[model samples]
Target chain A: MSAAKKTALCAMLCAVSAVLSTLESALPLPVFFVPGCRLGLSNLAVITAIPLVGAAGSLSVVAVKSLLILVTRGVTAGIMSISGGLLSLAVMLLLFRLARFGFVGVSVASAAAHNTAQLAAAGLLMGDVRVFSFWWLYLLLSIAAGALTGVAAGVIIPPLGRALGAR
Target chain B: MKKLSKTPLFAAADIFIIALVLALAAVPFFISVKGAGAPLSASVKINGRDAGSYPLDNAGEFKLVGENGIEMTLVVDGDGVFVKDSSCRDKICERTGKITREGQSVICMPGRISIALEGETGGADAVVG
Candidate 1:
């Protein structure tokens, strides 16, 4: 309810999201598919923060989580991770502003944006535009995964928001 | 907010797309194996002296020798190339299995090592770059 309470709650959410992301990073995927390519469980915090604390708060949470990861993981992977986070946050904020499609829509958009950003980064890093040939496949995958995680976040966050009381 | 319900349409779409990807991934396996490209043999020279040669075999195995008499085996498969056996921590190179496509690479940061596949495209419908 109070501004102070909201700030504190945002901070806590960011911390939780960082921890979730770190854990997700440890899970192994196939060798061809890049690891840490998943829209982390911590993104739930970002989705929740969007509606509860507004765009600024949501962006803050994303920035904090990315910064924490960057510091811990070092620069090589951190650069791409941060880029993806920023892109996801931007997409979620845009969707939240444009349509009242609720959390599901925002989550899907964020997920799609996240994948797009990563693929874009990969293309640039590898010095081959064909890298984006895989974008369509990854985009589809991100939407599915993003929707699943977004829905879960939508259900869980309101209560947590209430318990934490308007932060 | 309305209670979220699972939509059959979404599920159907998911299955269709997944099947499509599986099909795409499998095409390479079924196609006839073209003769292996110019065996990736080259005397890896750092400055002038020989570092080693990556004798690319049709069976997809190569030998990597370092300046200090260290030797490693690199294996390439349908999936990608990886250091089958290496005396390096982080096993990053080992984990980066054979890369058959252009722009894909496996880097061993500690060993200052890199194994990459260049000028080759994925086994999909030939969409030339």
Candidate 2:
């Protein structure tokens, strides 16, 4: 992809991810009843970007989202989101490259990774690993959230590729 | 990235992954629920500051003043510690009921107050004279 085109794609992906996260936070779902649990909706944009933009562009996508969060939430929240988002994006990229894991499986893995990283970050930030007590429930919810995002990605990616020649 | 597969989104590997994650998450959850030590004391914190610490041996009650002059009445009984009365509108602290084990806490977010039950230091308690 050309420089301008790459920048445009990265910008769009970042905006899409930020919007998805904002929408997710606005909607209070009981599914997130467990502490440190979110739907990982923003993962969709990053996953889609893997096949569209290269790894570098996708990394920027994650960075932009974290920066947006840092500005809006606070320093601590920004740190947590960056840690979790980067890990999740890396795992998803690896799974995509392997070509063995399917949509649901890869999404589930990324979501699990995201939750694990967030839990670890929170434990470190508070100076108490006991915060990991919520770890199990967070991962359990990841399965469902990942599957949902995977299905969403599946539904959107094909149409998007055809429309924009993403590949 | 690989070619986006045409197969159904839910694959057999997905089941295995889900099962693996579920099992992995269950271990810590059950351990935390088991809570090794016994309840010994109740530590109160208002907005991340230690308000007071009290032994949970006998029944007692006290008022906790939190941010914005939010007042809450904490009751410590044999069962554990809980919020019996709260000036906060939500009353979520009261709704949390009682906390009887270590790491258990009743938190009032509106007031930024929390009453947490601290368990015994070790599995066995030392009787010091």
- Top model number, TM-score: 2
Give the per-residue lDDT of model 1 (tens digit) for B1-100.
1212221113323344344444654554443243344234322332233354443343466677643343567775554456777775345556544556
Per-residue lDDT for B1-129 in model 2, tens only? 666545246667678778899899878655554434465788776666677887888688888898767898888787688887688654556765677777666655445565666664633355333
Error of 2 at B70 (Å): 13
Model 1 spans > 4 angstroms off: A29-34, A130-133, A163-167, B1-74, B77-129
Q: Which run of 10 residues does model 2 chain A get worst, by summed lDDT?
A: A125-134
**TM-score of structure candidate 1:** 0.63
Q: Model 2: how far is B73 from its true place, Å? A: 8.9
DockQ of candidates 1 onward, in order?
0.10, 0.34
Q: What TM-score would candidate 2 get against the native?
A: 0.76
Q: Specify the highest-lDDT model's number.
A: 2
The number of clashing residue pairs in each candidate reads 7, 0
- Candidate 1 per-residue lDDT, tens place, A25-55, comes to 7755453254235645778888777767777
- Compared with the true structure, all predictions reach lDDT values of 0.58, 0.75
